[model samples]
Structures are given as structure tokens and as C-alpha cells.
Target: MEKPKEKPIIELKNVLKKYDDKTVLQNVNLVINKGEFVTLLGPSGSGKTTILRLIGGFEWTTRGEILFNGLDIKDLSPHMRDVSTIFQDYALFPHLSVENNIKYGLRLKRINLPRESIKPSIYKKQKNLQKKWAKEAKDAMKKLDKIQAEYEKELTKKKLPKNKLVKIQQWLDDSDFKYASWEVWPSLMNEKFEKKYLTRKITNDEMDKIVKDVIKLVNLEGHEKKSIDQLSGGQKQRVALARSIVIEPSLLLLDEPLSALDAKIREQMQQFLSDIQKKLGITFIFVTHDREEALRLSDKIAIMRDGVIEQYGTPKEIYDYPVNKWIANFIGDSNIFEGKIIDNDEEIISILDQKIKYWSKYKFGQNEVVDVLIRPEDIEIKKSKGLIKGIVETIVYQGSYYMIEVKHKQYKILVESASEFEIGQKVYLDWTITSMHLMTQEKEKNKNKDTVSLNLKLNKEEISNE
Candidate 1:
């Protein structure tokens, strides 16, 4: 048997958020395992950034639990949470030099919290756990989970009563100790002792070492003395990243950090960020509206729409098997249509005299209408003998390759070809059976706005005179 998958470093369970009367996010569920590069991708106002804020503890869910290392962290504050976010606007201290900014979080002194203000719900046991019971408590918390999982499986097999199920759930939620708080001085004489104990700061040598190492990590070793104003946009972005990562947070959130950079620099930073994530083995939750950027950088992508995750999977899965027409159009240039499947075999699929062939992953009845999507690059254009002949409408010279638009009476197809083809030139467009993606016909009927599907419906009568 295969080994079980490790638990997520951070998890959002049915998270929902509301701003005044507006529900920004509803029933959001996401899991990010350790060291995984996951991206939340969507257009603006789609709530992708809101998800990052939730993970960073800058925003809280209106309902549902946020878990860190299997423990519920619904009550954790921004500083208390072990997460760092790099926003679009670097958020660096204007007066600090790059070296000081990178070392800022690491050299921070202890946060002075009054003992009474720290509630049980907002506390971590590490701050106050007794020395003798600390190890035992930690082991128990970790070990009990696996044991409970096994027991739950057995219970499911036995089909236990509802009351027994409740009992098991209660046992799982039970904790040996609750709340974490700062200790107060018992008497006037002990006040100085409390200040000494509570006030903690890193050594000068340690801060120096961390700043030096992180500066090197971000490829800004020599430029450590430079202020924010002295650095370029990309350099400033690097400094922001170094600051977030130097403290070694379990999860790193990047909210469109590359948005301000030019295309070339953005590409460079993309590779740099990905390489760093791999080298450090830290989980990255990147947020971006640029579909290509998400596809290029993320190991897994969660596509959001109007505060909900429309689909979540690998890039290949999302590309080859889009769950809907909207997703098919968003990621790439696709030719989507409601086509009729005529036949299964060679030329037997001929209708009237047009032997058009389309590939489908699912088996549908002959003569059944279905929704199909095929990428422009997937289709090959041939000057001579090809699958379907069409009149070239236009040719776009795209640096590396030519994009030729072909019109076949009612059908318009886009093909990425190596060679250039002139306007009104006759060409053949072809694709392998696997290149076509199919969706439900009923869903296609629901499309009110024909976006990608519009390229095919131009008036042939209007073009006849031309």
C-alpha cells in the first residue's frame, strides 16, 4: 500500500467572510500541504487576495475554522500567527535600509502583553506550559490524532449510533490545558524580574548573521546598505520577499508581488521565487490574476470566481479538462462550440459532405450535441492537404511564431503555425483526437455571453462581397 499523504501545514475549513452587508467569501475550503507551491488565481474582485489576507491573519473568517499544524487557530492575532505575506505594495518601512528591513522581524523584542488581557482562546501553550508536562502534552496532541483517525474508520465500519459519534467528536476536541497568557509579577519586588523575563531580544551577532545570510539569499548581498529609494522595483520586491522569509514562517503568502515589474523582470522573479521556495522547502500560497503566471509557477492552482473556488487541481488537469466554459476561455485562446457528434469511424462521420471530426474524452451517442473546446496552439495549419480547409482571414506575427486565423464558412479557427500565411489564403487546420475537450450540452445552453464562441458567427453574407 502507498504511504498516507502528509497533513497540510495550513488549512481553511468552510471559511466564509462578510464585509458589512456584503458576503465576500462563502463556504471557502482550501488545504495547503507543506512545501507545496499553490496559487489562488482569479480576476480582480474574485476574492483571491482576501484568501491570502485570511491566511496571513490580516483578515478573519466570519465563520469556520483556520487550522495550523492540525490545531485550530481561529483566535490567533496577526503577530501570533506563523505566516508572512508579501503584498503588491512591498510594505517596507520607508526610513529603514534594505539590511535593516530584512532583519526587522528576526531581531524583534518580545511583545508586551498584559497577563489579564490574554484569554484562553487566544493563547498558545508554549508560552506558559509547565516544563515537566510540555513534552508529554505535545506528544499527546500529535499522537492522539492518528489514533482517533483509525478509531473513526472502525466506527464508520461498525455504523455506530449518533450519540456515540458525538462522544467521539467531543473526545477529539478535548484539550488537557487551555489558554496561553503572559505572567504578571506577584508583588512590587518582582516587577523588575517580570520585565527582565518578558523582555526578550536577539543578540547583535545573531541579527548580523541572519541579515547577511538573507541578503545573500535574495542576491542583494552587496546592496545591503541601499535604502528603499535607492533600489529598483525588482530589487525592492526581492527585499520584501527576503523580509518575509528570513523569519522562516511555515507558510509564505505572495499577493501579486510581481505585478509592478516589467514583463522581462517579472519572468526572472518568477523563476527566482520558485527556486527559492524549492530550496527552502516552505509552502507558498501565491495569489495572482495573470493566468499564465499562475500556470507557469504553481504546482497546484485554485481558480476562484466571485468569492468561490470554481476548480482546484494541477495545471494539466485544469487545462485539459476544464470544468466549465468560463474556465476554458479564461486560461487560453480556445474555440468553444456546441457541436453535433455524427459518427465514430473514418469519414463515416461525414455530414452532408463536410467530414468534420472533433475529439471527446467521453463517449456520447451518435448525433448528440455537446460542448467542445480546443486550444489554438493545438490546431496545426497546413498549406496543403489537411483535415479541414479554410480561408485565412489574417496572420499575426508573434515574434517566435505566426498566428493564422482561418475561416471555414460558418466556422472560424485560430491556429499557431511556424510559417506565415497571407490573408484570403486557403489552408487546412487539423488536430489530434486528444486535443478536444468536451463539456455538458446543457451547460453550454446556459451561456448568455458568447465570448470565445463569437469568432465563428461572423456574417458570411457580409464577407461575400469582400
Candidate 2:
């Protein structure tokens, strides 16, 4: 049975962006499925950030549509759209404590309190319960506020342990106070509180619950009272993440959030972010120039170049079967061979005047020039009994393996091996025919050009004749 298609949470259709006659993005089309970690990957000037900003409503598209949850949201403002963004710099308020910083968005958020009709007797019972506990609840709140302020002051001097903070949070959890605030206690104790209460903003209790939950989610429990300046780069990033997620946005946009960190910290944060996204199950659209980073974190990657998406696919598909030479080279190291099909039946090909037999799923026309790519790791180095022989030009040690560059008559091949080889040594290179991947050339102005798909169809007919 076929699996059901996942719903698309965001879509960009023929999206174009320009700046004063300079086109930044051109005819971009993309679909991000719900809860998928999608990355927009490219070097600078590829307009990766422009696509992010357009979807975020920071910049309007020149021509096309942006959809969220199947509805067009091209004109919605950043705050109006149910989206949150974590910028490259951790945008936290230095003056505010970590907990306050996380609560910043929650404080500004407005939510309509739900109203429900109830029996008069039940309503009176609820009101009586509120009146009985009102004074004790107010006292509990005052004491909680005092303790929190004192904790913040203590954090400035020295960092406290997680157990100490947990004790304070435990007190709140154990209390019987369920009302939002003491100031609104009387309003909540009235009849309207049970029937048609219309408070439109998040109450203190709601804000505290949300902030606490997000802080715990990001593992920032003990550091919640520390000011922004007191934290490390990774901690600051976590604070920014907690702040954005506290409001529970439908989607999260991360714009190179880890670029500024040190190598070790960046790697650790990559795993941290991946774990967090999976835990929350939120659709994350991350942007980065690092190919390895994109490959590691993204469920789907869109590789952009010169204001257009050159290719978009899973990391394995893009790495193993790149659509063109540029993408193959940009993605990873590969040895490219430019050759022509010299014979059709025997699958003989000519590369640099040397005839070799190749195997491919798609058939090649006679004398047709094509590009073949073989990854460096796919080629094996042998002392004898191989398809081609070469002289080792350079050998570099890469901790776990050695990268050996070999020079043939007119081609330079790279081979990664566990065994070290000396320079100037003769080496035989061999690989299975199935390891070779044929690349499709970019289309030209001719509308009737034959592509790989057409060649595959023609090949199927020839096989039927046998």
C-alpha cells in the first residue's frame, strides 16, 4: 500500500525577489512538509537569506506566491504570521535576566480566554472556592515574586546549581493558586469569570508556565536568572531559542544561528538543535553555507546558486546522483570524466583517447558526449591488477584515513584509503562499473533537446528487442 503524502506546511511558487533592478531570487519553487527540517544551502550572494526573509514577511516577493498551511500569506507581516525567527546574532536583551528574556514574547502575546456556560450552582461553588483561596493565593504570589527577584540578584554574583532552582519551582507547583494574577482575582471571582470572561492577554500564571516549560525544553533551568552578558555563546543561543519557542509559533526560521560559535561548540550545537527540533516536532527552515552542516541536519536541502535553486533533494540523493557537474563539485569531492560513447552494444566509452567499458541504467547514443562522476571514496587503490594505473602525486594524512592524489596521463584522480602510500609510487586504480554516475547537462535554448529521461525510455525499447 502507498503511504499517505505528508502535508505541506509552506510553499513558494515561482517566487522572485529584486532590489532596485538587481534580481536576488528568480522563479524559485519549493515545498516544505510539516515537521520537516529543511535547509536552504548556498554560498554568499545565492539569495538564500532573501528567500527566508520573503517567507518571514520581512521582504515582499517581486512576483509569486507564498503559502502557509495551504493559504497565501504573502502580505502578512512578520508578527502577524505564525512564524518565529532566530537571527544569526543571538538577539537577547542584555539588561534582562534569562527568564525575563524568554518571557518577553509571552508578555506581549494576547490570547482570548475561553468562556463556557455552567450551572448556576456550579458557578457559585467555583466563585466561593476562588474567594476562600484569594488571599492565600495573593500571599503566595508576593512571596514567589520576592524569591524570584532575590534569586536574580544572587545569580549576578555566582551561578547557582540546578537543585536550588528546582526547589523554588517546586514550591509554585505545590501551591493551590490557579488564578492568573492577584490583581485580577476579584474579576475572576465574579459571575462573568465563569460565563463571558473576556481577558485578551496572557495572564501571569500562563506566562510563567510557558516560560518555565520552554526554559526546561532548552536545558536552561539553572541559568534562567543569569543576565545575558554572564552566559556563554551556546547558552545565549539557547536563550534565543527558548524566547522564540515560548510563544509556540507554527514554524521556526533559523538564519545561520551557529555560524559564530567555535568549531567544537558549533558541532555540539548542531546535534543539540537537531534533538530539540525532533522533540518539539516543529517545522524548521534553517539557512547555512556549510555543506556538511546542511547534510547533517536537514531532511531536505535546496542548493541555490546565483539567485536560483540549482537542485533540491535528500542529502543522499544530491550527494550520490547530482543533477549536474556544478552541483556534484559543490556538494563534495568527485573525479569527473568527460567521455563519449564509442560503441552502443558493448557499452564502450572513450575518455582521453582510452577506451573503457561502463555500465549505466540509462542508455547512451553513439558518439554522444557525457559527463561521468565517481566519488573519491568509490575508487580503490591497488598495487596491481586494476583497470588504470597512475603515479601518486601527493599523499595527505587525514587522521583516520589518507587522501592520495594520483596523476594519470591526462586525468588527476583522488583516492581515500586507510593505508598510507608514498609519493611518486605507482598505483593501480579500480572501481566497479556501477559506481559511475552519469550527470545530466543543463538545458539550453533548444526546446527539443533530449534529456536523460528520454534516453532511458529509448533504452527500454532496445532491451525489449532482445
Candidate 3:
């Protein structure tokens, strides 16, 4: 049985953004499903952030639609849409404590009530009654706490009987005073406190629970009272996250939120962000230039370049089978070989007079030129006889593995091996035929258009195969 498809929470349909004569994004089409962590990944000036701003309502699209829950939200203001944004700088209130910062958005938020159902006279009466009840409830809670503490102390000193203790516990449990302010005060005051306010604003007690939950979610429980300036970089980031998520937005836009942190903090925050997203189960559209970070944190990655999404897929798909040579190099280290199809029947390609067999979903005509990519880790280097012989030009230690650059004929190939190899030593290189990936070549003229079209086509094929 197949699982039902998840609904898309946000979609960009041929979205284009322009500032004066400079075009920021052109023909951008993307879909972010609910509860998926999608990353807009690219180098600087690739318009990744521009797409984020457009979806966030910080910027408007020049010639396309931005959809939220399948409806066009191009005209909706940032506050009007159920979306939140966290910037790189954390955008926290320096003077405000973490709790206050998280509460800020909820305080400004309003819930609509039916005016016909709530009369102004009745509303005013309930407003006063609510305040009276709130005070009474707080006083009752304090009395209950004091009484319970005194009883507990007496019991600890063996001055109170066990029968008395049991009766007291039962009485306390049965009373409304046992409930927290958020859980009990509202009902005691008015069954519908929201209707009491003409402006339909959240009550202080309601906002308190929301802020508290979000603080705990981001792991900033003990630091809620600390000012923004007192927080470390990661803590400040959590505060920013809590503030944005407190309003319960349908989508969260994070623009390089961890870029400002140092290496150790950045990695810690990445894990923290991933955990929080999973716990909340909200759509997160993150933007970052760090390829490794994107691979680690994203369920889907949109690789943007020159104001266009070059490819959009899972990290493994983009890394193992990029659409073009540019993406292959940009995504990760690869040994690329320019070749031509020698025999279409056998799927054979000629690379530097060496015939290599490869497999690809896309077919090519005989004599058609193509590019073959094999990752360094995919290639195995042996000191004995193999398919091809080469001289080890350079060897660099990369913690777990050694990166050996082997010179085969006039071409240089990289191999990742756990065994050590000496420079200028004779070595042989080999890999399974399935490890070789064929990619489309980029054309200088109409490059972006071609890349986008090919990417769409390739993605369609990939989906069909799946």
C-alpha cells in the first residue's frame, strides 16, 4: 500500500523578482511540503535569500505567484500570512529578556470573534468580572501553596498523622486551586475569555504558556529571564527561533541563521535546529551557502545559481547524480571525464582512449559527447594491476581517509583510500560501472534556461523511475 501524499504548505510558481534592471530570481518554481525541512542552498548572489524574502512577504514577486496552502499569497503582508522569519543576526530585542522577546509576537496577535454574538455591554461586564476572578484565583492558589507546604513540613517532622495527610492530599487534589493559572484561571473568569476582549487579543496568561512552551522547545528554559545581550550566540539563536515559533506559524523562514556562529557553535545549532523542527513538525525553509550544512539539515535542497534553481532534490540525489558538470563540482568533490558514447548498445563511453562502461537512465546517441562523474570515494586505488595505471601525484590526509590525486595519462583523478600511499608511487584505479554518473553539458548561451529545463526534465524522470 502506498502512503498518502503530504500536502504542500508553500509553493512558488515561476516566481520572478527584479530590483530596477537587476533580476534577482527568474522562473523559480518550488514546493515545500508540510513538516519537511527544505534548504535553499547556493553561493552568494544566487538569489536563494531573495526567494525566502518573497515567500516571507519581505519582498514582492515581479511576475509570479507565491502560494501558501495552495492559495496565492502574493499580496498578503508578512504579518497577515501565517509565516515567520528568523534572520542571521537573530533580530532579538537587546533590552528585552528572552521571555519577553518570545511573548512580543503573541501580545500583538489578535483572534477574531463574532461581533453579533458578543454584545458590547456584556463584553464590558465580562471584562471586569474576568479581572476580579483572576485576582481571586491567584490569591486562592497562593493560600493553597502555603497550606500544602506547611502540611508537608509537618509530615516531614512526623508531627502530622498519615490519615490527616491522606485527607489533605485528597482535598487539595479535588479543589480548583490545584490547577495552574493558564489551565484554570480562564475558565473560572469566563468560559470564553477571548470573547471578552473587543479587540480579541490574547490574554496575559495564555501568552505565558505559549512563550514557556516555545522556550522549552528551543532548550532555553533556564535562560528565559536573561537579556539578549547576556546570551551566547547559540542561546541568542534559540531565543530568535522561540520568538518566531511562538506565534505558531505555518511556515518558518530561516535566512542563514547559523552563519554568524563559530564552527563548534554552528554545528551544535544545526543539530538543535533539526531537533526542534522535528519536535514541532512545521515546514522549515532554510537558506545557507554551506553545502555540508544543507546536506546535514535538509530533507530537500534547492541548489540555486544565477538567480535560478539549478536542481532540487534530496542531498544524496544531487551529490550522486547532479544535472550538470557545474553542479557536480559545486556539490562535492568529483573526478569528471569528458567522453563520447562509443557504443549505444553496450552503454560504452571513451575517456582518454579508455573505454568505460556506464549506466544511466537517460539514453544518448552514438558519438554523442557526455560528461562522466565518479566521486573520489567511489574509486578504489590498489598498488597492483588494475584497469588503469597512474602515478600518485599528491596525498593529503583528511582525518578518516587519505585523498590521493593520481595522474592517469594526461588526466588527474582523485581517489579516497583508507590506506596510505606515497607520492610518485605507481597505483591502479578502478570502480564499479554503476558508480559512474553521466551528466548534461552546460552551454554558455542560454545557460540558465537550459539548465532549468534539463533539471525539470531530469527530476520528472527520476520521479517516474521511483
Candidate 4:
């Protein structure tokens, strides 16, 4: 058996950042592996920048240690660390040429090595390596073609027809005979693929390969000659990313890098950022206040409020399993009920007024008061055949979805669906027991957690009763 790998390139241990009376980050812990793109997602004022600053040495941590290559970097200054930060403003010197701007960080360090001295060697080596890989990939493709043609002929000529075997062979060929993968595949099958898989170590060449690929991946392929002002906001952002990644920092910190671009540009940039992260295998800690952006781009998301991280997990986890009522409503649209846990049966739970039954591996005692959260998308709205009935308070026609509000007894349940409904019309609202999400916590009366629904009907009568 092969041995396990070493620790990550950068690790933040019990990190905390404070400003005057307020604490920005509270015992933050994260590990950024070599060539791993891990995005840090949260809203504004969530200390997302503070974590970046701590890693970049722009700000000092009040408590924890920042480690680089498994050594303490708490005392290292920004220049000392190999990390380079790309700020939202581009922060490029207007007077300097594009070439000079790229080399600015190196210049500030005042390394004994001259630009002329290193440029030829570095670029020559990179060009030669690219040529070598291009030839190898070309050769591999030729070999694969010959092998595949031979197999295809053999398969066609065989008297014993193998339907299952044919399909399996097709699968192997489709997979490039394990030569390349959708991402990465088994090490044993491809020697070139496994060349970088050393135990407890990550090669600098591996980092360089990703860095070079990201430059192309982000579509900044020919902008090496363009000046800062000459490029548009989207182009500038891509260059900023190229600058940040050239050194192959263990942690890549992005602070709302796409906010300045137009909607179309933003979408395009988002795809580039997402794709580059995957291809480079870099840990990206992306900070954004946009809910849609966070939902679309993040692998794991941390929804934050004020200076606190309200919830943290994979995008699906946070969207599905919110810790509390605030979090449930924050990340997405949720229909919440401020009620008590009445029955608390072995598997199911009953909320006040609404008896919702769900299978739970977790056990709770009877008579436990809790808040029940149901996502707007989870609740189904039909014109007929629903248990809880109400008059449609409102009907909103969104391009792709519908918002529905149904008044039931004392509460108004909001439902989101692809179906359309009319306002002031009567409708029925119901949900499967499994659709109910319960939160065993106290509720805040004034805070209305129900987001917009497709069709809804509510007025004085519904408000007075509650």
C-alpha cells in the first residue's frame, strides 16, 4: 500500500482577528493544500478579508498561528511569504508598464537576481516544457488511435458477438483507455498522470503547470502585452487573478472580484473563475455578498452575519440543513413556523398548529419547543387536493418560477413552484412529511422569515389572528 501525503501548504489554526471592540474572526481554522482551489464564501463584514489579510500578512491575527509549509508564519511579513494578493481595485501603478506591473512584486523584494538574468531561463524552461508536453500528448493521441482502431477491427471480426463486452470496450475507449479523465483517474493506469503523486510532497512543477493553465483558462491568453487601463473591468480582473496565481500561493483570496463587471461579463467571469479553480487544483477563499454567486460557485459556503459565521458546509448542506431560522432563510427562500415540538415521536415531529411528520435519525423528547423551517421550493401548491386551504393573497410572475402565498388558519404559507396562479383566487397548499425541516430553537416574533412565493393571499384578517 502507498503511504499518505503530507500536510497542506498553508493552515490557519485557531485564527482570530479583532478590530477595537468587535471580533472579526472567531477561532477560524482552515487548511489550503498545495494547488487546491478552495473558495471562502461569506457576506460583507464576515471577516473574509481579515482571513486573507492574515494570510497575506496585511493584518496580524489576535490569537492564532498561520503556517506555511508546516512552519509557523505568524511572524513572517507579507514580503517574506510567497503569497501575492490581488485586491478588488487592481492596485496597479498607472505609470508602470504591464511588464513592469507583473514584475512589481519581485522588484519590491529587491532580490539579488536581476529581471534579465531570470527572464530568459524561466521563460525558456517553460516554453521547452510546454513543447515537450505538446509532443507527448500528440504522441499519446497517435498511439491511442492505432490501438483503438485495432481493437475496433478485432471486435467487428469476432464471430462470438459480446454485447456486454462490446459496451465495456466502448466505455474503455471513451475514457481514453484511462489515459486522460474528466478530472483525475487511477495512478496505476497512466504513468504520466501518476508522475506527480509523491507521498508527503508536492512538486513546484505541479504548481507551475496549474498556474500556467489558469492564465489560459481565464482567457487572459494574449493580454500579457496590454496595459491596465487598456483592458476592461473583466479583463483587469482576469489579469489580477493571473498575478495572484503566478506565485502559486497556497491560499487564493478573492474579494468580490466580479462585482464591478456587467451582468453578462459577470456570468462569463464566474465560469472562468470556477473552471480555473478546478483545473489548477488551488484553494480559493472567495468573498462575495451576492447570494446567487455564492450558491452557484461555492463547493462549501459559509453564510455570515455581522462578524460571525452563521453556518458553514457544502452548498447543498447549507441550503438543505440550516442551523437555525435565520440561516434557513438567509441562504435561500424558506417558510418557517414559530411553534413547539408537541409529539416528538420516535421518528416524526409535530409542530404547533401544523402537525408535520418526518423520519429523523435524531431523537428528541416530547414537548420540546422548536421552530419548523420548510423551504418555499419544498412546499407544493395545487389548485385542488391539498390539506390546508387558503385564498391566494398574491401571485408573482417570475420568468422561470412562480411565487405563491396561501392563507391557512392563522398562518400564511408561501410556496414556490414553476406553476402559475392568480391573486385573490382560492388555492390549497400541502407538503410531503419529508419536506418539513425542523429547528429546535426559540423564535423571534417580529422577524418575518417567509420569503416571496409564487402566489400568495394575505391581508388584515390573517395578520390580526397571529
> Which has the greatest TM-score?
3
Query: What TM-score would candidate 1 get against the native?
Result: 0.73
After superposition, the stretches of candidate 1 with alpha carbons farther than 4 Å from their true spots are: 1-4, 77-80, 109-201, 341-368, 441-466
lDDT score of model 1? 0.77
TM per candidate: 0.73, 0.75, 0.76, 0.67
Worst 10 residues of 3 by lDDT: 175-184
Q: Can you list the residue pairs that collide in candidate 3?
A: none
Over the stretch 323-359, how does candidate 1's per-residue lDDT look in tens digits? 8888888877888767666785431233213557656
For each candidate in the order shown, give its overall lDDT on alpha carbons.
0.77, 0.83, 0.85, 0.67
Candidate 4 to native Cα RMSD, angstroms: 20.9
lDDT of 3 by residue, 1-466 (tens): 9956889999899988899998889899998899999999988999987898888877788887878876567534455478999998878899999999988878667766668867788778877887888788778777877887776676677566779878877876655325443335544346445534544777888778778888878888899889999989888988898888888787899999999899999999999889989888879999999999999999999999989999999999999989999889998999999989999889889975788787999998889988889999999999897889999999999999999999988999999999998999999988888889988677764646888889999999999999
Q: Provide the lDDT at 367 for model 4.
A: 73
lDDT of 1 at 231: 91
Best by lDDT: 3
RMSD of 2: 20.2
Regions of candidate 2 where Cα sits further than 4 Å from its true position: 1-4, 75-80, 110-200, 344-346, 361-364, 442-466
lDDT of 1 at 57: 76
